[model samples]
Target chain A: MNKGLIIAIVLIVAVVLFMTQSDKKEVSEPAMTKAPPPVQVEPSPAEPAAPEVSLQEAFEMNRAMYGKGHSFAWNGEQHTTDHPEEIEASKEATQANAEALLASAMAKNAEVAKLGFEWKLTGDILKKAQQSIDQGNFQQALNLAAQAKYHARIGIEQYHYAQANWHLSVPE
Target chain B: MKIIKTLALNLAVASASQAALAADSGFDMQTVDPEADRIALQNYFKARFPETEIADYVNGIYAVDAGSREQWEELEEFPPYEFDVEKGEELFNTPFANGKGYADCFENGGIGIRHKYPYWNKDEGTVKTLEQEINECRTDNDEEPLAWGKGAIAQISAYMAWTSRDKVFDIQIPADDERAKAAYLDGKKFFYAKRGQLNLSCANCHVQGTNIRIRADLPSPQLGHVTHFPVFRSKWGALGTLHRRYSGCHKDSRSKPLKPQTETFRNLEYFQSYMSNGLVANGPGARK
Candidate 1:
């Protein structure tokens, strides 16, 4: 009587436990499924966007690079030279800078009128960029713009650099 | 009271140290002696290039480069600059709209005066190039100043330089005036100063690279740089003033060029011309 009673009790308890465990699994599966899709979507595509940046952001980065770029070739900021669109933008910025500098040079004295030819070269390069754009040669446009920007930057630096360094060449 | 005495002692020591520092490292102004510079410069070129005749120095890099010189001499026979000289003569003799002429503002009727230019104007406290003088002459006569550095001004300069052939450069620095000395010194500084994106000075080319060649062109010795004005270049296919050449060089170095006749350019002209004191004027010359 003791052995039969013990066997029956064991079978009954095992069946009950198994049933409860299966119920729990069934209850948890849909909840887990429903919760995951949107959450997974949110993080993978959203926050630590490591690989890519927008064009505007890229341009800002470029500006920072040229303004404070790490290359010894530039004052630290290497202009956005590698990319066509960014180079085009940089050309406009440089042209504006050159024009502003030219005006400033003029205001100090009307003698700045003499630098018309240098500024004309900037305009000519810009024109070349436009032609490149018309020809759908964006890379060529970028190259031209890059060259124009360099000239513009140089033009802006011309008067001041001369003023600052001319005295250094003075005989002691 | 003790603090006051300590402060007073510190001040005295500071003054003494500063005085000593100044004595050791002062501003160190170089006295302007154009004649001495001319002699030294001549000796330098002469000693460095014993084969080159002193008179031939005015011929620029050609004087030292026989290969380029042989080709250059043949080119000079026809002398493409002839048209420019003729045009310049006409422009020089023409009167301004104000009924006054260029002759009215210059000595010797503006003829044979290229060697006398880039003079330090004692009254103006600035240097003036022949280019500047030509513009000034026009402006003084109620005509607008000619555009210096190129074009018509260069033509007039070409004519003037041609007419002034055989005349020696005679740049002066008044020994009594400290400003003149400062101008000359400043010009020298500019010549030697490392500048631009390339960090080059005038000396980098004219002084050091005179014996060297880049591609096909040789940098000429600085001895007679001023004797050639408004040179006709094969590359330009047009005449260019020395200042125009200066601007181009600066641009090549990734630096901006100052306006023509600015104190910087003028002072440089003054200094360079002074160094070329005895070189014969052989401007309106040709170059490749």
Candidate 2:
């Protein structure tokens, strides 16, 4: 029994000693292993990267708004938005559309002063619409634009009415 | 037994040492190109909105003309042009129902802390932005996270940017570390990811020429986007956090909006800031 007890104690002590020494050795080893150098990422170039737009969406939206090989037509005159040469042609068409309608209204009213009042009101509404558009208030601008369109329509209607009904002074 | 015990000890020590080294070698800012960035930015804004008085409105809109470090410092006292800075400041200190404020969750209430974004957790292989950082803090403290575009996150972001006004940005994405690289890659994927009914990606309008049709404008590319964030938008009539911008972009693209500070957005912010490294910080800017 004494021999057995002694052997058991010796074994336990040996195990403990081995553990302590091993721990020390392990602790010291990491100090020697240098960490691997950092991976170097190649810096991306400075200029902007390639475009990321969905080609389909761009193509479709463009096609819908300005059709493929489309032409802009006003008052039996044809023009193209894509062509700078046709810009003047389009602008003149729009102006003529506005002017012809205005002339018809003025002819019906016969009173030059009344026509002047309507024009002034139309200008005032357009100015407000432009101001709102510049301010990024899109909803407000939309409302103002609608109002201007309505007034312009009324101006044309009144011009036609005066031309048909108003008495022209027969010149001596 | 001794050999096995020795092996375990060696592994533990190795990991601990590795951790220490990783933390020590933080980010390096020397690689950032300043002049190229400036030229790109100048070309971007000039080509897009040339009719506007960009130079005059640089303080609010254009990031370039917002002045040097010294100028930003001086403009600090004045409320940023469109943001409700004073209101944001008041809200920053206000405690939530859980009896905690923003200071408890962040270092220095997140002031002048615009960089080091889009961080990833290698263990999870995921990314996080500043907004996500804030929300995580809130969750840890048992407080409800604020909704995007409204409430604390937006206000706090505005206030943080305002306080950080005029410092140059220096975001770092660790290339050497496996984890850091994953975060950056994830961020890149997000920037390019396309979604929504509009079927648009964040890169679509911001990266593509969609800005071309609306006006002479094209959205600024990802490069140099990090510097001016948490801006005061004229459309909102209030200061907006970076997270708000993310949500707005998502909404604009017709995608379901992500919560403010969500992990996905945080990673995106990290990637974005990384691109704009070395640009002067002009947070709390007024934008159209």
Best by the lDDT measure:
1
Q: Encode model 2's per-residue lDDT on B1-288: one tens digit a residue.
A: 665465335434533432332221112233223233334434544554565443322243233332232455455566454345666677777877788877777666666665545455556666666666667777787877766665566666666667776666665555555656545544555564444434344544453322323233334444456556666655787667777778777766544466666566766676666656556666566555
Which 10 successive residues of model 2 chain A have the least lDDT summed? A163-172
Give the top-scoring candidate (DockQ): 1
Name the runs in model 1 displaced over 4 angstroms: A1-172, B1-32
- lDDT by residue (B1-288, candidate 1, tens digit) is 665465446434533432332222112265445565567557666766899998888999999988989999999899989999999989988878887777788899888888898887889898878888888788787778877767789999999899899998777788878888788877765675555555456765676556565444578878888898889989899998888888887776545567667788878887888888878898889988
Candidate 2 off by > 4 Å: A1-172, B1-83, B95-100, B121-125, B193-200, B208-221, B255-260
For each of the candidates, the C-alpha root-mean-square deviation to the true structure, in angstroms, is 20.0, 32.5
Model 2 chain B scores worst on lDDT over the 10 consecutive residues at B23-32
Tens-digit per-residue lDDT, A20-96, candidate 2: 99998778877647466779666476853333444444444555799645654443345443322122123332334
Window of ten residues with lowest summed lDDT in model 1 chain B: B18-27
